[model samples]
Target: MPATCQVRVLGGFGVTVDGSPVPAHAWRSRRAADVVKLLAIETGHRLHREQVMELLWPDLPVEAAGANLRKAVHYARRALGGPGAIAVDGQVLALWPDGCLDCDLERFNRDADTALASGDARACAAAAARYGGDLLPDDRYEWWAEEPRARARSRYVALLRAAGDWTRLLELDETDEEAHRAMMRRHLAAGRRREALRQFERLREALRERVGVGPDAETVALYETALAEGAEPPSVEQTVAVTLANGLVAWGRRNVEEAERLAKRARALALDAGLGHELGEASTLLALVAYARGTWHEQFRQEFADSVRRSANLENAVFDAHLCFQEFYLYGPEGHEGAESFGRDLLGIATAADSTAGRALAHLLLGEFALLSGHLDEARAHLDLSLTDAERAGCLSAQSIALERAAETQVRRGDRRAAAALLDRAMPLAHSSGIRSHLVIRIHGLRVLAAGGLVEALGAVRDGERLLAEATHVCDPCSMAFRIEAARACVRANDLGRARRHLAEAERISGLWQGGPWSAALWEIRAELRRATGQTTQAAALFLEAAELYSTLHRPLEEDRCRGAAGVR
Candidate 1:
C-alpha cells in the first residue's frame, strides 16, 4: 500500500508525509516542480499524461519527448523518497495517499476567488494571510512561468485590499472586539461612565479569552475614569470611500446609471473630508460616464481638467487624460485635435508611471485616432500594444476595445477576413466581462459580417436591424456611429432593401445628433439604396447632399465617393 501524503502550502511552503514535515528537497528537479505546481493548481483534477508532456516539452519531437518524460518521472520519484512516495502507472500519477503539504499560493487562489465571488471579507483576509509570497519565487526568472505567477500575485493583492475595506465597513463584523474596544474608548471620552465601564469589561473579557491578552494600559485607564465619555462615535468618514469603491465595481459591471449616482455621493463625501484623491477619482469617473453617455466634449474636458487639478495624482491624472480623449472622440467631429492632445498626454503619463492599465488605455485611445486618420501601421502598432497589455492585466474590457480597434485597422488595410476573425475573438471576452463596450463590439461585428457578405440580403438585414435596435437602446453616440458604419458595409454588399432599413435608423439618430461625419456617411448609403431601387433622381440629390456634408467634415475620400455616386466625379 502507498504511504499517505499530506501536501500543504496554504499558509507557508511545507509538506507533511503522514502528518510529518518532509524536507523541501523531497520534491526535486524543475520538472517535478512544474508537475506539482500544475496539479496543485487544479486541486483534485487529474491532468492527462499527454497534456503534461506537451506543456513541459512543447517543442520536443514525440519519440524523444516520451524518453525524456520517463527520465523526469524517474528522477521525481527518486527525489521524493522512492517509489512508494510517488507512484506512476501508464499515463496517470498520484501522490502518496497520506502525503500532505502546505501551499500558500493555492490557498490564496481558492479563498481569494471565494471572497471575490461572494464578497466574503473573512475569506479575503484568510487568503491574504496565506499569500506570503509570489508563486514559486525561486522560479521567478522563468519567462514562461511569469504570467501565472503575476496573475496569482494580482488576485491576492486585490482580495487583501477588498478584505481590508470590508473590515472597515462595520457591516461585515460589527461585533469585532476591536470595534468594541474602540467604542469603549469613545464612550469614556463622552462622559458616559456606566456605559464606558460596561463596554470596557465586555471588550476585556472577549480579548482575554480570544487573544489571551487583557486591555492595554490606555484602555484600562479610560475604564477606571467614569462619566468621562460615551456618545455615538464621531462620523467615521467611511461612507464616501465605501461608495466610491462600490461605484468602481458598478462601473466595471457596466451599471453606468448606478455608478454615476454612487460616484456623485462619493465626490460629495470626499469634498467634505477634503480627500483630494477620492474627489478627483470620483469626478473623473463621472466625467468618463458622461462621455460614455454622449455628453459634450467641452463639458467633459472642463470636468476632466478640474479633476486632474484636484488630485494631481498619477492614476487620477491618467483617468482624466483617458476621459478627455474619449470625450473628444464622441463629441464634435472637428475636435480631433483634442483627442490627439489627450492621447499624447496619456502616453507620456503612462510611460512615466509604468502602469500597465494606464499604458493600455493610452494605446487604445491612440489606436482609435490612428484608425480615424487612416494610418494603418500606426493603428496596428497602438492596437497591438494595447491588446498585449490588456491581456496581460486580465482586463477583458480593455482587451475587447483593443481588438475592436485592431479590426477597424484591418478593414482599412483591406484585410476583411482578418477583421472578422478579430471581432470573433473579442466578442466573447466583451460579453463575459459584462463590459459596457459590448455594444461597441457588436456594432463592429455587424460591420465585419456585412463586409464579408457572409449572410444573404434578408438575413443580413434582420441581423443589422437587431444590432441597430440594441445600439439605439444604449443611446450612445459612439455606438450609434459604429452601427451606421455597419449599415454602410451592408450597402456595399449590395443589400439595398436591408440598407434602407438601417438608413432610416441612421437618419433618426442623425436628426437627434444634429448630423456629423457619421451622419454624412449614412446619407451616402441612403443614396446607394435609392439608386439600387431605381429612384435615380432622388438618389442623385441625396448623393449631392452627402458630398456637401462630407466636404464640410473634411472627409475628402468620402466626399469624392458621394460625388461619384452623383456622376460628378
Candidate 2:
C-alpha cells in the first residue's frame, strides 16, 4: 500500500509521511529535498525527467543532470518512505502516484476555482481563508517556483478583494491603496464621515512610509470630500458619472431602452455643465447606446459628432480612444479608409496622456486593424500588449475585450485549444461589460466547439445553438458573425439542416450591409454547406466568390484558404 503524503507549501514548505513529519536528518542531501519540493508543487505532482533536470540543474551538462536527477529521485523516495511514495515510469516522475496526497495548494486552487466560476461571495471568502499565505515563501528566489507563487498570490488577493476582506488584505499588504480606498468608500457611503477620514489618513501614512508619495488626485478629491463630511447633494460631474454608470449597469442587464434614456440624460447634463471630461464620458455612453441598437453608423455621427470633436480638442484621451475602438470594432478596420492611421494617431494620444485605459483600448483597435489586414502575428502582439495594459488599468471590460481579440487571433491561426483557454478566462469579465450577453458569448462558441473531441462535436453544436437562441441585442453585424460561425460548426458536425438555417439568417443580415466580410463569410460557409449536400460544382463557385471578397478585405490568409477549398472542390 502507498503511504499517505501531506505536503504544505502555501505559508512555507514541509512534508509529512502517514501524518508524521519526515525527520530533517533523514534527507540524504539538500538537492534531494528540493527535488521532492519541486515535484509536490507542480501540477498533479508530475514532471518529465528532462524538464525536472532543466529546472533543477539547467547549468549542468545533460548526462550529468540526468545522473543527479537519478540520485535525487532515489534519495527523495527514501526520504518520503517506500518506493510507491514517488513513482517513476521511464522518464516521467511524479510524487504520490496512489492519489493519497493531501496538498494545501491543491485545496486552495480547488476552492478558488469554484469561487471564481460561481461568482459567489461566500465561496470567495472560503477560498480567501483557505489561502494560508504566499506559496513557498522560503523558496521565493527559485525561478521555477516564481510563476506558481505569483499565480497563487494573485488568486488570493483577487479572492480577498471579492470577499470584501479589506482589513485582512491590508494586513497582508500595508500599502494596498485600492483596499484602503474601498474601506474609505464603504465608510463614506454609510454616512460615517469620521471613519472615512480615518481610513484616508491610514492610507496616506501607508503610502508615505512605503512609496514616499502623497495620495493621487482621485484619492485626494475623496479625502477633501471626507473632510467636509458625507451626504451632500450630487454635483454636476457626480450626476453625469452616476447616470453613465447606471446606464452601463442597465446595458449589462440587457435593458437597452433604459440605458438609452440614461445615456441621453447624462449627455444633456454634461453638455449643460460644460465639463469636458464628463462630456466625453457622456458622448461615449450615447455611442454605446447607438451600438447596442445597431445604428452606430447612421445615428452616432449625426447625434454625437460635435460632442466627440469637442472632447478630442479638449485632450480627453479616453474619449478619443473609445470613439476609435467603436469604428474599428464595427467595420473591421482596414476595409474602411484611413482606419489604420486613425488607430496610430489614437495610440500616440493615449501614450502622451499616460492613460492606461486609453492605451489598452487603442491597442485593441490596432490589433483588430492588424487582424483584418491578415497580419495574425502583429495582431497577437498588439492584443498581448492590450491585455497587459488592461490588467494594469484594473478595468474588467478592457481586459475581457483584449482576451477575446487574442483568442480570435489564436482561432484564426488554427489553435482552437488556446482560443478555448482564453475564452474561459474572458467569460466572467465580459458579463459585467454586457458582452457576456448571448449576442457576444455565442460568437466564439464555434471555436470552443472545435476544441472539443470531434466525435463529440454534435453535442457541442446543440449547446452552442441554445446559447444562440438567447441573443439579446439588435446588432446585425454581431448576429451575422455568430450565425456564420454556427453554420460552419454545424457543417463540420454533418448537421446540414441547422447549417442552412444559420446561413439563411446570416445571409439576411449580410444583405442589410453591402459587400464585406459578412458576405465573404456567408459565401464560404454556403460553399461548405453546398459541399455537405453533394453540390460539388455549386460549392466550387461559392468558394471562389468567397475568395474574391476575402481578397478585397486584404485577408490574404483567408483568401488563400478559400481558394484552396475551391481547388479541392
Candidate 3:
C-alpha cells in the first residue's frame, strides 16, 4: 500500500508521509523536493514537462533541463515512497492526488472561495483561520510562486475584512492603510468617537514610522469628521451630503420611488443652501435615479451638463465629471454618441490631477468605447492600462471591472479559452469584496461564455443565474441585456422553449426602449428562433428589421451582420 502524503505550502513548505515528517535527507536533492512543490501548487497536482523544466531550470539548456527533470522526479519519487506518489504522463508531470495526498493549498483555496461566494461572516472567519500564511514564503522570489502568493494574500485580506479581523490584517501587514481605515470606520459607526480618533492617530503614527508620509486626503477627511464630534451645527454642505447619501443608498436598493423623492428633497436643500457644488451633485443624483427607473426625462443631457457647469467653480472637478459620465453611460440608447466626449473629459481631468483611480476609470471607459466600436487592439491597450493602473493604486474594484472588460474583449476576439481564464481570475476577486454589480458583470460574462459553447463555464452558470435573479433591481436594462444573451445561448444549445422564456422576460422590461440596441437584439434573436423553427420568410424579415434598427443606432458592424444575415437563405 502507498504511504499517504500530506503537503503544506502555505506560510512554509513541509511534507509528511504516513503521518511522519519527511526529513531533508530523504530527498536526493533540494531540486527533487521542488518537483513535488511545483506539482503541489497546481490545480490538479499537474504541470506539463516543459512548464516544469522551464520554471525549475530556466537557465539550463533544454536537453540538460530534461535530464535534470527526470533525475529530480526519480529522486522525489524515491523520497515519497515511489510510483503511487508521482508520475509523468506523456508530456506532463503529475502528483497522485487520490487518497494518497492531502494538500493545504487546495483546502485553503476551497474554503476561501466558499466564504467569498457566500459573504457570510462566519464563513469568512473560518476561511481566514484556514489561511496559515502566505503561500510558500521561502519561494517568495520565484516568479511562479509570486502570483499564488499574492492571490492568497489578497483573499486572506478580503476574508479578514469580511470577518472584521483587523488585528490579524495588521499583524500580517502593519503598513496596510486600508485595514487602518476600516478600523476607523468601524469605530465611528459604533459611536466610539474617541476610539475613532485614537485609531486615526495610530494610522498616522504607523504611516510616519513605516513610510514617512501622512495620511491621505480621504483619511484626513474622516479624521476631521471624527474631530467635529457634534461641536457645531452641521453645515449646509454636510446636511446636503447626508440627504444625497441617503438617496444614493435608496437607489442602490432599487427603491426608485424613494430615491427620487429623496433626490428632490436634496435638490431643494442644496438650492436653499445656495451651494452650486452640492446642487450639481444633487442634480446628478436625480439623473441617476431617472436612469435607474429606465425613463430619462427630456432634459437628462442638459441636467448633466448643468451639473458639470455648476461644479466647475470647485477645485476638485473630477467628481462632477465622473457624475456626468456615469449618468450619460446609463442612457445607452439616446446618449451613446455623447459618452465618448464625457469619457475623454474624465480622462483629461484624471490625467491632469495625477489620480491613478481616476485614470483607471478613464481607461475603463475608453476600453469599453474601443471594444464597442469593434477596435479590439485599442480595446486591449486601454483595458490593459486600466488593469495596470488599478493594480498599482490597489483598487480591487477597478481591477475587477477592468478584468471584466478585458474578458469581454477576449470573447469578442474569438479566444474563448482566454476569456474563460480571465473570468476564472476575476471570480475570486469579485466574490471576495466586489459590489453586486461587479459580481453580476462577472457572472454575465460566465453565462455568455457558456452560451458561446465554453463547456467549463456551464458549471458556473447556475450560480451566476441565481445571483442575477437576486440582482434584477440593480439595473433594469442590465437584466434585459443578460437575458438576451442567455436566450441566444439557449437557442445555440437548441433549447427553443427556454430561449423563448428568456426573451419574454427581457421584452417585458424593454418597453421603455422599444427601438434601442436591446430591442434590436431581440429582433435578431427572434429571427434566429424563427429560422431554427423552419419559418424562413419570417426570420429574414426580422433580420432586415434588426438591420434597420442597428443602422439607426450607428452600429455599422451589427447592421452589416444583420444585413448579411437577412440574405442567408
Q: Give me the candidate number with maximum lDDT.
A: 2
Model 2 residue runs over 4 Å out of place are: 1-265, 268-281, 284-337, 446-460, 471-476
After TM-score superposition, the amount by which residue 30's alpha carbon in candidate 3 deviates from its true location, in angstroms, is 55
Flag the better candidate by TM-score, 1 or 2. Answer: 2
Question: Per-residue alpha-carbon lDDT of model 1 for 368-415, expressed as tens digits?
Answer: 776665577997999899888877656666787788778777776678
On the 0 to 100 scale, the lDDT of residue 38 in model 2 is 85
Displacement of the residue 481 alpha carbon in candidate 1, Å: 4.0
RMSD of each: 18.8, 15.7, 14.9
Clashing pairs in 3: none
The true-versus-predicted C-alpha distance at residue 150 of model 3, in Å, is 44
| Candidate 1 minimal-lDDT segment of 10 residues | 205-214
Q: Which regions of candidate 1 are displaced past 4 Å?
A: 1-285, 288-331, 437-450, 454-475, 489-498
* CA error at residue 340 for candidate 3, angstroms: 2.7
lDDT of 2 by residue, 357-464 (tens): 656766877887788777889999988998898787665666776787788888787787888788778877766542234224443554444465654455555555
* lDDT comparing candidate 2 with the true structure: 0.70
lDDT of 3: 0.69
Backbone clash numbers for all candidates listed: 32, 0, 0
Better of 1 and 3 by TM-score: 3
